[model samples]
Target: MILDRQLLLSNAQPITATAVSTNTIDLAIARDIGIGDNLELFIKVIAAFAGGTSVQFAFITSANADLSSATVIVQTPAIPTASLVAGSEWLRVQVPALSQAAAMQRYIGVSYTVVGTFTGGTVTAGLALDREGTAYYPSGLNSGGF
Candidate 1:
């Protein structure tokens, strides 16, 4: 069987607080899925600042109301680790392929942390997804014969 998936930007709030610190944002989705399902996540980040800054991205999974137990599935490309000139948008990072095993049920989310020094700034992030199934069968001449 094949499955189609889509990831909508559920949140896009501006960053109000200032000061050098790490901020984590989380996005979650719940649905019934099976094992051997392939999942791909895409992310786009826009930075609006005048000074240098760094950001870290990660993908995680969790159960209903149990975010504390969330597990990290993948970490985004290494931090830019340089001066992010004003009005800079980084390329979208494509998360590594993730397979849903029998242990996983309903719940997937993306989390990220933005850390840097600045007077004040705003950053925006978004996510997209694609999915497929993994199943194979060998050619056969008949139901009971090879």
Candidate 2:
């Protein structure tokens, strides 16, 4: 069976998850992704503290999940000497390329830490996949010829 170009699936969305002290944010794969596919992972860190505090953002994943994962794709200096203002404060992390194993059914995880003091905060993260090449082609195509 052949697939058409329009059958290709390319989509992206935002996934937000909360982060606690020394805890990892488990991210679920929205759909089955193929190898060589590009995925962007965004991480937002919102610090909630009574006084000034510091926080570090890190990216993590599971080996058992059969997905290649890396930490600190976009390495940013630790957030320090800042007060957690009311509202959503965050940092964004983007993973340009993604690697997948032979096995299917895999997911990614994100984790963070607060170096200073904060009552609580939220860590928002998500994945975006590139599906440009996933399209199918029809056989036997004829162009304007004599």
Candidate 3:
């Protein structure tokens, strides 16, 4: 995939898992991003004050910058089987292309959330990958247009 890793957020503040205001992540998608490509996400846990907490990640798509009209695209299946281990914990996720559905309007992003009690976890940085993002045809073309 032709993608680049870009930082979405770097929080010195601890994330409150229950609140979207604290745990949500949003990224701006380039207008020319390819429909065949997708934006991948990563959440690297810098610290978790409490261990053994199950966390989940969710993906959302939106047309607005504030993520007001957002739709949950990839619903986190369930709380992760494993528990947080401070520096050892990291997650990777991706959003699927709209495919036959109409082209993505303007923006795309993902978030990390947990169902149960979560307190004092710091995410050093949230990174994203926009596959084939360098150009609509990031993969380049074959000779003779074949």
For model 3, state the Cα shift of residue 11 in Å. 4.1
- Give the whole-model CA lDDT for all candidates, comma-separated: 0.42, 0.40, 0.50
Candidate 1 residue-wise lDDT, 1-146, digit = tens: 13233343223333333211122222233333322434344333344443435555555556633334666666656454353434444434554433434434345554545555444345443343343235566786356653
Tell me each candidate's RMSD, in Å, in order: 11.7, 12.7, 9.7
Arranged by TM-score with the best first, the candidates are: 3, 1, 2
TM-score quality measure for candidate 2: 0.44
Model 1 compared with the native: what TM-score?
0.45
lDDT of 3 by residue, 28-75 (tens): 433443445555555556775464256665555667655566667655
**Per-residue error at 57 for model 2, in Å?**
0.4
> Poorest 10 consecutive residues of model 3 by lDDT?
18-27
Judged by TM-score relative to the true structure, which candidate is superior, 1 or 2? 1
- Of the candidates shown, which would achieve the greatest TM-score relative to the real structure? 3
* Candidate 1 wrong stretches, greater than 4 Å: 1-6, 15-39, 47-52, 81-99, 102-105, 117-146
